[model samples]
Target: MTQPMVKKMSEEQQHLVMQSMDMMDRFYDEEFGLLRSSGEESSAHGTRGSAHYALGLLIRQKSGDVERAVRVLHKVLDYQYDAPEEIYHGTFATQSTDEHPPAGHYAWKSFAPGTAYFLERTFEKVSEAFIHKLQEENNLLKEEADVKQLRQLFYASVHGVLPPVWISYDPNWREFIACVCAIASAAFSELLPDALIQRMDEAMERAVQGSVDRRLSDAIPMNTNIELMHIFITHYYGHRLKRADWMQHADEQAEGLLHEFEQYGGTFAEFNTTTYYGVDLAVLGMFRRYAFTERMTEIAHRLEHGLWNNIALYYNAKLENLSGPFARAYDMEMREHSSIGVFLYLLLGKGYEHLTGMNCESGHDPMIALLGIDVPAEAVPYFQAHQGDRLVQKQFLELCERDDPKANRNLCTASAWIGENRMMGAMSGSRNTNGQMHPATIHWQTETGERYYLRLIRRETGGDWNSHLRGITFEAEVTPDSLNIDVQLDTAEEIEVYFEIKGPSIRHQDIQPERWELPGLTCTVKAEAPEPTMLMYTDYAEIIYRYVPGKSENRMRFELGISD
Candidate 1:
């Protein structure tokens, strides 16, 4: 079989990749050959960040940069735990300082694939000078372990540490198996010992059998990122190993994902997420470059276009962030750097003011650039043009009853209204318990040139606000200027409604029992409950409305409106 062709990067794309690399350069510890952690204040070094940084350096194609990249890779390898007898034999720490030894076992999933991908691409496509640099770096790092030995160690560690459980047991099984495929593919290409290759091939067959037994490829409501990665890697390794079953599974899943996107008016179950969207984009780029079938390639292109369109639709140009009732998100606001912002910065180029700087989660950006994925030409206008008042409504499927596909229980809906000064959005029937789901959210520009945010949350009276209130049903009706929310508790457990707002300072008098007039907006609350108590902080404030089971009302209704 022929090797897949890597797409050529455009001049603009090359510039953006360099621009991101420049940002990463600021955090690079030249002496140690590692990257400092994500934030400006962080002094710790990250193993995954260092490896990804090396990938970015390889993209630069300078001999000196290649040498530096080799140094960084060598440093990263030193962090990997090599104790074959230990449970966490192959993993690197997510981040480490002088006081803290590397400890995260899950780090392998994040760093291994990129490292292996780098090695594979270098051996196959890079110049002899690059290989010599790698060899030189290896000799300096460890006299006995040459490039071949280094590759063998990497493969051994990964193969040893990966859990023996069926691939379908974990929600993120796709990531684990993909990492395995990456390393094995690299090892095979480099002609590792036949015994090791045999073991890897056996492992791959087991993983494939488990997936087929569980019908994972047909599973609906899978995490968008996981599904995309599954499609790409399955198709890739299938073609490499001449496994028709894996290829067929990949095609079926790709087609299903595309059909779902088209049928749902282009919505991801993990819709409007800041982090996973970038992962989805990166995997699509993989499909664009590596898929053996024409149909798979076409699906990737179309899905890429659809995702960009939705991003544009949700983006509030005035606020310089995506407006949401996010299906899942790490941060409420996009002023902070996130994976999606990295892609946007790449697409929009310099002077794109929304992003703060590069974040650690942007490890996918280098691969995205290398694969030559960019914002579709048609979607460009939405980002460039001024956005006016508009409402976007979408339907997405949530949890599915695996035994009965026709239960009609998977339907979920989300709506967003974008205005000149503010954007408001809400989602209904999302059962995500993870703190990532925001059912109702609003972002407005304050008169004083600051952006303010407000989100509605329901939690157990004193439980963590990030997590969902167990057995609670939440629904919301959203309009251009108002939100009507209804929350029902399953067990009559005492719960609290939190209106978390971030912006300028807010005083007690600024908020009345049913009304609030803050810096850039005014809000009037309509509820049967008593007045909310205030919890003020330096940069944000929260208003909590407590509810009792029988004394007041079991069902709580909130009518919140934004004033003109």
Candidate 2:
């Protein structure tokens, strides 16, 4: 929704926005400028821009600056600190940057997509870069029993080999660094020299000798955590890295991480990295091997579909609120756009495929995305159905602006676009009064009982004046005893029914029990009255609830439940 009335920035606001973007550009420029190790800690924390590295690489690829991009990526291996054991790379640490040793945190793990995007774009030259490195150092790989040659060869081919538990790395994160390292090493095969490959092979065997308990006991897996993104991306790139073969223990931990991550509502709150690798993790879980369990798939679905929906906005027009963790500093200007991009990537990449193949048990057919991943589409109809109130208001306002008194004064009804068994209201409206006299006759056109909303708000006007006419009028294609519509009122009132089609029999109550639609019970001294208790029918679509004074924001939620 475009804000027709865009607030012009004052001198102060202009300066503020510029300052923030300037800071953003600078932080990302410096931290991601080099391909240093994740262990390289920055003085600035959340501001450290690993995503920038990927972006920079992307720019380089498109702009034909491949050499520089490769050079930058290569620097990641040169990252050094006082203690290599503590692999914590972040620009900002609680300790001072002077004598205090820099923490070697693994920033690349979270920066998978950005890096993968860059690598994929530049593989043409990256292929050459690997060949260059492999051919350049040919002396190191001779199979000599000499430990010096073995250590040097190991050191040459590798960027840095840290322990399984990277102190600065996220404990639950998959092995992104592993993929990068694997690619770099494989590309540099000639330089890996036969001796180096042999030495590294021995080194790898020795590396794995720590036993399952030792590796599983690790946290953050910083020492050997890298290239996982590459491995996963390899799935798309024609190389399948086996998780079960790599480290079964890590996969087990990944499942736990996924569970705990879901508990946190899909926000990687515990892992404090600027990069949103959680998106990557979500995709990784969907792979055929991991299967990630059914729970993992559900998490991915919710994570992609979930966002803050304002009822007022949803009724008016569904707009998501991007007030969540990934909002980093919360630039409302691009928050929703950013989150939506990530969600769509996950949706098209996995969700669409998942949706297309399965039969939805919810009776309604699931819709797939542009890429056609078979995933059940979230039921957006629930919100759409109730949005008639919003549409009617909009229509009323437009009529007012046009000076169409006859049209403006006429009560506008919410309209629904029903499909098969489902009923949904894309827009809504009610009666518009003229000269203080509210119009009584409202015309509603419907092929079926697809959309309906009505409420008479009473201002706590005791029993005498409280009895007002607030009836829901319906024109159903096939009329039954009653049709359900979600409703909740703060006060008690009576409804007069006038059904245009078939019988005037609308059950209004018999529906889903879990949905709890009945609100409250109170008999008032109204002129035309029948003692009807407030209905709280849960399973059914609608509710009729009594409201409390001063607490008016409470809403009658209409949730979409799609079963497969």
Candidate 3:
């Protein structure tokens, strides 16, 4: 896996590479002499810098522009520093300028470790590529001292007093931090001073120890990829660090991952069908190549295949949507077809045609070049079958469970893909309203040629004491152009179900309980229950569907005539 790459770029690839460079040029703030959103006095400074660094490297490698790459590289180095007395305080501006309060203010300047790691890794790349040239010419843009300062800053930051805040509660973040910490420590181990080496060792020890200690202290929930990385780092350096129970947590997570993969083929831990799948797949691929033990390799391959299975199963190439009543989702806007599909193409060479006209953004996983991993032949069939001349890709899961901390629930969800429109619905399971998992979500192109997304919610009152009413015993029937959701409630209390649709060419008129219409498109909305319901228009439209306890299931049927 570590062998040097002999693959050369094709003419078409060369064109796309140049186009990517052009797409990335906007992110650089020439006037401010820094990256866009690189506002030290504003929020998200670290992210801007990190994005700049990664995109810069891609440009540098693509164009072989040393001066251009150095400009972006300096932003990272100039942002980081090493102070003799106050290590943590003088490191990086915790977040933004406002975050840097008056002298004694206790705003913990916890630099985002994941962002730091991303920047540092890219820095390593740029250093290896352009540092020697800059040193020879004395470019005055960057120097060996800048590199030395960054190395010292890495030491101080990783081995500081408060132990890198570990920023978010997201396991993805932590896993990234842990993996980068291990790799960074290894990369600079011999180069670092003895004291820095001990410090790095101690810091890593604390992280490993902290993870184990947390498992013992708290009922640790499992993140499959996170645990795999943890397991790798611990096992890789366990001999040096005297921790007997180090691998236990990671082992538990790996076991959980294997079980889920065997059962479901792959699990989408996050709701976004597009971003997370690619991120997770890339992470798994990294686990396979970087941590390539026999057992790890087997586990990694199984997980990768499982993910590909899901991607193939749900992909709607015509619509460029993952056609989902996603268990969890960030928003209704799913770019899975473009982004995740590209990653899949890179992993398994045959899928590249799916990405033929899709937008490939900057700041994607750079490991496609670094690791030099190739797509396996086994995955080609899966990609081929999904990307055919099919107008619709329909799928249903009887019982799907997600291990989200906020949402430890299960539901029956179905996907109906008709061209570029996706009509997805879920009947049962407690949904995190923040995730926007309405009972029925219809994403369809109107007859007037505009994309529309509609969220149909069955809001119930007199249910449980909680504000959010959880639907129990859900039944969903999926058709080519419609979805009928039959939901059972906790109480027979009266509920108000409404539809809020937002799109370019959608207008509501003649809104009624039995009959509502959207002009220009052959779409109609009708609600019929066991009893009469009140219907009115608020922001969108509302229907008060009454549910009698122990009597019948509340049924809401939505239909669209924009399908073949």
Best by lDDT: 1
Give lDDT tens digits, candidate 3, residues 1-564: 221111244333433344444554555555444444533333343423343343334333534443454444344334332322221222333222313212322222232323333343454466545545655686653664685665556545443322332231222333443444444344323433465446546555644554543334322333333455555666544634655565555555566557754553345344335645555665665666555356766777777766666665565544445655554444455543334645544544543544534343334433333333344565555444444433333222221222223334343334444343444443344343322344456665545556556555555553321133434334544555666665555643466554555554333445444444544334444444554454434434444455656665655444433332
Model 1's TM-score against the true structure: 0.71
Model 1 misplaced stretches (Cα beyond 4 Å): 1-50, 61-221, 353-356, 400-409, 491-494, 548-552
Tell me the alpha-carbon RMSD of every candidate.
Answer: 15.0, 26.4, 16.1
Instruction: Estimate every model's Cα lDDT from 0 to 1.
Output: 0.65, 0.27, 0.45
Clash-forming residue pairs, model 1: none
Residue-level lDDT tens digits of model 1 in 1-564: 222111246554565566667788888988667888866557788766676676677666554765686567556555543433322333444565622222334333233323322433343344335446666775443453354465555544543444311211232443443443443345223333454445445444544444443344233234677668767767777877898988888888888889888888887667887777877887777777667789888899888888998888888766777888887776776745366666776677667634635565555455566665557786776666546789988788764212223342356788999887888988887765556778889889876678889898777775676653445666887997898888766645577777888887767678876888888889898975656788888878888888777765666778997885
- Per-candidate TM equals 0.71, 0.30, 0.58
lDDT of 1 at 523: 89
Candidate 2 Cα deviation (angstroms), residue 380: 6.3
Q: Which ten residues in a row have the lowest lDDT in candidate 3?
A: 81-90
The weakest ten consecutive residues by lDDT in model 1 span: 162-171
Is candidate 1 or 2 superior in TM-score? Answer: 1
Model 3 misplaced stretches (Cα beyond 4 Å)? 1-44, 47-172, 180-244, 265-272, 336-338, 344-362, 368-439, 445-452, 457-475, 486-503, 510-521, 528-564
